[model samples]
Target: MNDQVELVAQAIYEAEHGVCLWEGEPARHKERFREYARNAIELLDEDIGVLLLALQEANAGARLRRSKGSVRRDPN
Candidate 1:
């Protein structure tokens, strides 16, 4: 869809499969995963906000078109 949406989706995919450099240490790996998880959550939240705003704008435009009689309805 939108460029920003695509970027966010890619970021999410990367985050889910991210690898830690300290691969041999269990504690370090867990810590790195936790950090990545937090960042992913924030990014997801921001993306959701953007999508919601887009939805609202689209709805408003549709409503305006309907009020102006530019959008037509089916007789069936």
Candidate 2:
């Protein structure tokens, strides 16, 4: 839910909407879709990287907390 990730999500939604809801011949908008696809690729690699790192850190923290809590039960 970071800003960067949100932007990426918006871009993806717009791309899907534009492609699916075009009113005219699809061939006329090939370049536009191509640009959208390219931008999506960059966003996936750049913006999502932050989210991925955040998730990794969160998972690590959760695991640490679980281990600490479970240790208290080991001797019982």
Question: Can you write out model 1's per-residue Cα lDDT over 1-76, one digit (the tens) per residue?
Answer: 2434433433444446663223354675555545654565466675666654654575467568778896577889
Total backbone collisions, model 2: 0
Every candidate's CA RMSD: 14.9, 13.3
Show pairs that collide, candidate 2: none
| Number of clashes recorded per candidate | 0, 0
Supply the global lDDT for candidate 1: 0.52
Best by the TM-score measure: 2
After the best TM-score superposition of candidate 1, give how far the Cα of residue 20 lies from its true spot, in angstroms. Answer: 47
What lDDT score belongs to each candidate, Candidate 1 first? 0.52, 0.53
What TM-score does each of the candidates earn?
0.33, 0.37
Error of 1 at 2 (Å): 24
